[model samples]
Target: MLRRSGLQALQALLELARHGQQWSSVSAIATAQELPAPMLEQLLLQLRRAELVESRRGRQGGYRLSRAPEAIPVAEVLDAVGAPLQLSEGPAEGSDGRAETQVLQSMGQRLQNAIERELKQLTLQELLFDLESWKEYLSNEGGLMLG
Candidate 1:
């Protein structure tokens, strides 16, 4: 969550899937996203191991998604990159007085669930288009509903 690599991987994969259509060198992706090269390398390694992405070697060598963006759920990437939520095991003091802690834990779980739902359904193509559209809107109107 703090690292942002999980989301970054999703964006990278989706962008490559949508636009690359062939090979997308990591350097290009890193430059485009303005992400650190070393970090990108590490993330790409993790994605490769998770089978979410595959790489080619040589001049035309680069990386691409192993499966369709729609097929690769954001939840899957989150799991592959990091645990859903940083949930510690429930307290050992299982008692009625622990209701407050339980409530907090439940709330956390709910938040994680909501995030997972959004990520799982959001395809790479959709995200890319949304970003491009938002940029255009911001540039043109400078605000959502300019008066």
Candidate 2:
């Protein structure tokens, strides 16, 4: 599961991409996505630092994707927002401490690797293309609750 901030960051970028090359203000994105403006602004800052989005200043100031959405991978967005696949830390203190821990760690590693591989293959463009399904699911199922 992604943290709330991570989801917001992704949404913010999606909004930017949806506009093509046009800049989207933080307020516009926040309103469109129903996310908090301040928080979205913060998330955009992180994305800017990661070079995923570029900002303009002055009256028409806002943000636009730094490059084409197809060039930005899902993993890059997640990494930019510090949302990586999470895994169990391992058993507390069971029968086989070292062995059990190793097994758990191994399993976590495999899962993480698989997730990373999949994410690498998915780009913001693909994600945006599938946005309609996501919105429908979210509306029908009350959406995913980000931590």
Candidate 3:
């Protein structure tokens, strides 16, 4: 499972993607996403280190995606945020639990494979577009505020 922090980081990046080529400040992103500034700062730093985003300094300084949203895979964001798709092994066991371990391992591998495959196919641009469409639909249909 992806960590909560990873999900938060993904949300922050999605927020940045919504801005296109423009730079976005941590405060603005956090405020918009209802996330803590400190958490977003750390996530941005991690993403920068991963070369997913670049940071600027000074009064008008902020962060922007290093590459186009369409080029960045969702898996890359998860990787940048340290959300690994693999599973960890449990304690060593004797022959009694060998079959159970094998079964669990197979299931875990299948799950990870499916998740990675889907995530690799997803891009921030597509995700943002879908979200915008959904928000529009909801607002028109039910008068809900998604922003």
Candidate 4:
């Protein structure tokens, strides 16, 4: 689903940049991630507007991360791509609904608070490092070494 496409795209771009990848078009990212061209294009536009990515305008032109991955956070990318996640009002005002709604309303607020707290704590640098470590581990279970 496109639900996580924006976040996924950001991760893909960060991974490619971390690997010294170079290509002249969105096709490169789309091909590498197996993402559709139109989808990648749409996300890329949002990224550009947020200044999270920049593109070159020539034969060797392609999109690239605009700043250090460490400087960006997953939450920021999500915000740039879509609306801020909000909690919903619970059930209608019948007796049972009111009873259930009261509890759900409190829980919803708590859930949103927790999510924002954690998201604020996460940094793109940490995410990228974790990703690199995972890929290395998978590719060389016994030989991948970190300094």
lDDT of 3 by residue, 16-114 (tens): 888887889999999999999998899999999999999999788899899988998988998888886656654444435678877776777787788
Residue 116's lDDT within candidate 2 is 86
Tens digit per residue, CA lDDT, model 2, 15-117: 8988999988888999999999988888899999999999998778899999999999988888998986555555654547677677777777788788889
Q: What would the per-residue lDDT of candidate 4 be over residues 1-147, giving only the tens digit for each residue? A: 224765666655665566453543878777777778898888888888999888788888888778777677766777888844555655554537566777777787789898777666666777777777777877846556353
lDDT scores of the candidates, listed in order: 0.72, 0.84, 0.84, 0.70
Query: Residue-wise lDDT of candidate 1 within 25-81, one digit each (tens)?
Result: 889888877877788878888889999889999999888888776677766776777
107: Cα error in model 1, Å: 3.4
Q: How far is 118's C-alpha from truth in model 1 (Å)?
A: 3.3
Q: Model 3's lDDT to the true fold?
A: 0.84
Which prediction has more favorable TM-score, 3 or 4?
3
Mark the regions of model 2 whose C-alpha exceeds 4 Å error after superposition.
Answer: 92-101, 133-147
Q: For model 1, name the residue pairs that clash.
A: none
Model 3 spans with C-alpha error above 4 angstroms: 86-101, 140-147
- Candidate 4: clashing residue pairs, number: 0
